[model samples]
Target: MTTLPASAFLGGFALTFSLIVSLGAQNLFLLRQGLRREHVGAVVAFCILADILLMAAGVAGIGRLLQAVPGLAAWLTLGGAAFLAWYGYGAAQRAWRGGAGAAAARAAGTPLAATLLQAAAITLLNPHVYLDTVLLVGVAGSALAAEARPLFLAGAGSASLIWFAGLGYGARLLAPLFARPGAWRVLDGAVAAVMLLLAIGLLASLRGSLGIGQQP
Candidate 1:
């Protein structure tokens, strides 16, 4: 059995946080839910728990199957890119049409079970999340010295707990701001921009892989 050092734990925390702390669909949805104070605990718990499971699976060599299958990563990247693009476009349209608040309220009205299910679907369906947690994080964890693996995982798990809790609860602090229609437009617009940029970048990378573009 491998154990991790204190330093390894710190390193894992930083690395894991860097990868997961992005403005993706999951984060956006969680934030929206948090702002409305609807199913906030459930959403945060699901995300954090999912992260723990996925990250552990990755570090346990379960993610190695991905490395074995050729072009698997590319296919996932393609799918993720497309999903991000569509999601971003929808967000942009909502923002442009000034319907973000309405949409959010409708979503909030959804049952807790449905909201949890949606959150799970959003995270599990995203190929990028699997790649990041299982493959990338697992591979990195596997590389740790025998004495530092445990600490590393601890650090990574801790980061997930901290980030999800913060993101889910922190949105409430901005409730007053989001209450304003103009603020909704700005917030939605920002979300749209982030999603679009992520999508474009993913697609560009895929294009490069296929030799469709000399420069991405």
Candidate 2:
């Protein structure tokens, strides 16, 4: 048996937390689900599971495969960008129009299966996730001794589990505030801005990779 390095554990936790704590499409959607009191468990579970699987795959040398096929990354980037753009447009529309009616309608939320499917799509389809969680984080894990890799991965996985659980459950605290239609609009608008910005970033990266003029 080998002792795990404390530094490796902490480093993995910090890196994973920082990468995921930001306001991205996945977070935005999670927040919305959390606020709406929908299938937050499923949402959070799917996200954490996705992170673990991706990270594991990356550490297991999937990153090498991804790096070899640059075109795959390009396609994922474009697809994810388009998805983000669509979601952003929808969120913007909701921001502009959501009111008491929207809040009330929340009770009749989307089907659980559909929600889970969409959640899966958002988590899996995003190209940045592969880059950040799988390839980058995986490389970091690989740096540690094989014995320490498990600890590093545990630390990384812990961040995902803790963060998603907190975000989803803690969101209910704002239920009172979200009671106001104006609040929903504000939240939706914020989500829209974040999603749109991310989409633009992905699109720019794709363009740059493809040598598409000075678009950025």
**What clash count goes with each model?**
6, 0
Worst 10 residues of 2 by lDDT: 1-10
TM for every model, in the order presented, reads 0.81, 0.93
Query: Over the stretch 79-152, how does candidate 1's per-residue lDDT look in tens digits?
Result: 76676677677667768777665566555487988888768766875777888889888889888776677788
- Which candidate number has the best TM-score? 2
For candidate 2, write residues 49-159 as lDDT tens digits.
999999988877789998998689888888888888888897888887787666656767899998998787678779989988988899999877888888899889999
Off by over 4 Å in 1: 1-4, 99-108, 125-127, 213-216
| CA displacement after TM-score superposition, residue 205 of candidate 2 (Å) | 1.1
lDDT of 2 at 186: 92
**Overall local distance difference test of candidate 2:** 0.87
